[model samples]
Target: MSASPPSPGLAPRPAHDATWRRDAHTIGLVGLAHGTSHFFHLLLPPLFPWLIRDFGFSYAQLGLLVSVFFAVSGVGQALAGFVVDRIGARPVLFAALGCFALAALAGATAQGYGGLALASALAGLGNASFHPVDFTILNKRVSTPRLGHAFSVHGISGNLGWAAAPLFLTGLTHASGSWRIALAGAAAWAVLVIAVLTSQRAAIADRAPGEHGPAHHAAARGEHPLAFLKLPSVWLCFSFFFFSTCALAAIQSFAAPALHTLYALPLEVASLVVSGYMLTGAAGMVVGGFLVARVTRLERIISTALVASALVLLTVGQQWWPATAAGAGTAALVLTALAGLGTGLAGPSRDMLIKQAAPPGATGRVYGTVYSGLDLGFAVSAPLFGALLDHHQPAGVFGGAALALLLGVACAALVGVGVAARRRAA
Candidate 1:
């Protein structure tokens, strides 16, 4: 509900006092906890083939299994925000991680599709609880000056969770010849996270709660839940975020098989390629975080990255490289690496831009609203791409993804140029 003029340039500054440092550190612990949950959370998407083989599922069944989780998680984030405002981040996040671990263990031991579906839904519930809580803690606890970098670190940590999961789970799955092993590993990690958080509970309570914060009231208003639909910049950013996430969702969902089918690599080896996509994304988040400090024109940077990612995806999609025998793995790796860079640059900028669009003190609502765009993007695009994969050639799927990215680029560029002009005129 206030405005601050932008400084003409960026500079490195020390973070706020010891309290802020302590809060950020606690958040960092949460980030690692999120990463662990995400390892199990994300592991399912890439493991579709393995699951199918293990459980005898059809493509439609597999699609529903994954899509339902995201659909639920997307709605879950908004609910989580409201919960965070009311109860504080500590308890909600602790519960989310704890439940997530239990769900993973359940899914691992699931004997049939029915049991796995229940586990998947529970995992979705766990994920939905975490994001809003995590963002609220960062926005509320961390000081203003350090928010950007802290968010970047947080985003990178989450991406690392996404990146590390496939490799770690696949390995555990491989060694033990059971998906249950992977779930057990995730459960163990969750226990460790809970212990760490429990140790830091006292330090966490000392962080200042905003005396007059409106997050509680705004969420309670509940009317006009789709209020974000009215804003131009929101739609623009939504499109940008939507397309970017489409790329991300596809890679996360399909990259392993794409690699395996195209290159003839084993399931385990193909899983590593999927890891590259996630790892590269983690690297991208770290880079994007630093760039936020230096790059004043985020719209331009996001547009440029989306366009580049589109090109890279096109290249990867168009060529039929048999990497099993020769050098195709390198090509697949390179394309995903570039795509990851695009993700890193775009992810935080999109969040920052969306946060800017809302009124002050409403970051939680703004983020929750904008995040729906991500869900919508994934929800719509995954089915479209999956259908494309089923109906058309592999090349067609990449081409379609490129088209989405190009649309995203145009949307981001238009919004960026408009914002820049408005700021200059002001």
Candidate 2:
């Protein structure tokens, strides 16, 4: 492939044309769509206890349901990216949202494990395309200077989606006395988002056929279609996502049960830990957005933030809380929150790092391939962490998460070195 650089054929837009209003509108719409996808991530995991109680399923089996979801997603995301590049992002987004609604409905009607597995497969297929679609629109429509803030909002919105899911699902389940009704409610939420986005379709649409101008210059070079596969930075970025998401999978799939076993906290309160972590993480992304604006050494920021998070997880694993009920609960909650804060702080810089690594005119393809690592991490880690919980190794959950973060740190350092080398060579 040819050298990757911003396209020169298209002159930069004027401030008037790239007005704050225009950019903010696009960011807001894309963020909403992104948030909806994330909300679905916890669609079933948040209801795991109910599934276990109602179905008499083992923890590992329930964990495999999540694995099924992400495993399908990991494979589909790469193909979805190429599809987004070929046909346009808007219509694929519409179809994906429709899939979420159908998945939720399917879960509501499920009679056993087979039905639940079908729901999971449908959800995974829907989850596969958001990164490619969202980034394509942002890169194409949003102003260059505001791209940092766009990425920041994107990450913040996703964490907020994570924070919202447990509250929405569990709260509704508690109120209705049925997990099925709560899932039905989720289906309605998906439909509402789809309707709203369809109305504003023009603002967030970009994965269309042909003529992407400067971003599509690679095609003009007559280079092989898969030439992006050769970039070292691309695979390094993939490694970074895979390892980092393993850390996330530990928290998302097993944190509540592990915390409950370790600290004797109520299952309800233990679940709130995920929410607190995500909210604080969102706040960290707010700060990270600013850091990316001022600092160019994005990898250093990622490494520092991740190490801080890992240390906190290690502290949690050590179980240094006071023995009293109040003290122990507070300690577990606060320590988990601190760990989440560190993770959140790294979010924007992580996105920025991937953005820099992406080949020009190949945003959809690169992002699709790189972000698929996220699906693989979740697919693999959920089962491993769930088994740790099953084996009565509750503390291993936290320790394993910390270990994943440290491994991700190594990948990020190497990515930084690789990116620097490429810049010098260029």
Candidate 3:
């Protein structure tokens, strides 16, 4: 029997869609785009074993690629914010994705280190603008009350991206017997995401005809372009990113390799530990989204969570575990994954605190400036930890990471106090 067409009154009406529906659509699209950018962050690192085998590269040489990538990105990201504010985010978004596709292709076809470096630079260029673009669109387009959940989704999607890269890259290589093919696959992913974003461009657009009020305010005030750089809380946020991501870069670059050395686990198995860490971290972001709604003091949440993660990393660094490698490996991986969960708990509060720090109408600039600290942290830490790995000190990666997290805790505390003072003064 042919199904009868629904009566007009019974049909689902798009006009009457709930507010949450529209917010969900915007949030979902932004999360997907954010996740894709993060997926490229690990594009080269996960292939280190393959690159080392093919090119006879040292840990320092390989680590330099990461340093180069972030160094380029840190400078460009600060500038990308101005472009985003001037030109609009949608076009820049398309361009960023295109660069990722090109980066992946460059990696796929590389014959040596220079080719790999070119790929890294291209990916850095792609990454340079995402935070500015993302936060601008979210703040402008999404409804206010849903913003906290949007940040949570953003953080969770990023962790998922970080988790997916190693498994995707290594699994493809092992299955297909070619690393080039794996990179080609990443290129295809970038292309697909670009197409998706282009189709939904209107929802994320910031430079639309009527959206010039914020830009006009800056011009009217005749404020210096670098004016936002003077805020104490802004630099404290930068310090927060710098120290925190030093710990993150350590894990991203060395965690799997360190696990392999210390535990006698195969590289493939050790890679799963990083994946586990990220997965559990994503889970933590879920609970944190709710936790931030109840907490008055964001710094306390940030402090407690990071301190816990630092302790776990410290424990692994101290090698306080069973005498047997098997027992120790199992225990260490569990502890590391737990640490990620604790860090994940800090994600929503971190964004909320940053939101509190931003002055009126300067979201893009403040986020761009502060987030450059993240790039700086990664650029400086990768080589330093690479030296530890070269010197046969697997545990220093975790210990150094713990120390960096402690620095981050101090910065977060300062930022929280500063924000509270500003509120009272206002």
Tens digits of per-residue lDDT, candidate 3, 224-297, equal: 66777889999999999999999999888898888878777677777787788888889989988888888978
**Clash total of candidate 2:** 4
TM-score of each: 0.85, 0.94, 0.95
> Whole-model lDDT, candidate 1?
0.69
- Per-prediction RMSD in angstroms? 6.3, 6.5, 4.5
TM-score of 1: 0.85
lDDT assessment of candidate 2: 0.88
Clash total of candidate 1: 2
Candidate ranking under lDDT, highest first, comes to 3, 2, 1
Per-residue alpha-carbon lDDT of candidate 2 for residues 224-316, written as tens digits (9 for 90 to 100): 668889988888888889998998988887888888888888898889988888899999989988998998788899999999999998888
Error of 3 at 314 (Å): 0.4
Candidate 1 segments exceeding 4 Å error: 1-20, 202-213, 216-230, 320-326, 414-426
lDDT of 1 at 7: 55
What digit string (tens of lDDT, one per residue) describes model 1 on residues 1-426? 677765545322333356566766866775676676567557466567678787787655776676666677778876675566555766787788777777778877888887777777777777776655666667766666676777777777777888777766777887888877887787787788778888876544423556434454655676444455576776676567677677767777766666556656565666666667667777777778777777877877677777887888888876655445466866675676567778677777766665666554455555655565666666666766666556635565567767887888888777777677767887
Q: Model 2 off-target regions past 4 Å?
A: 1-18, 207-217, 322-326
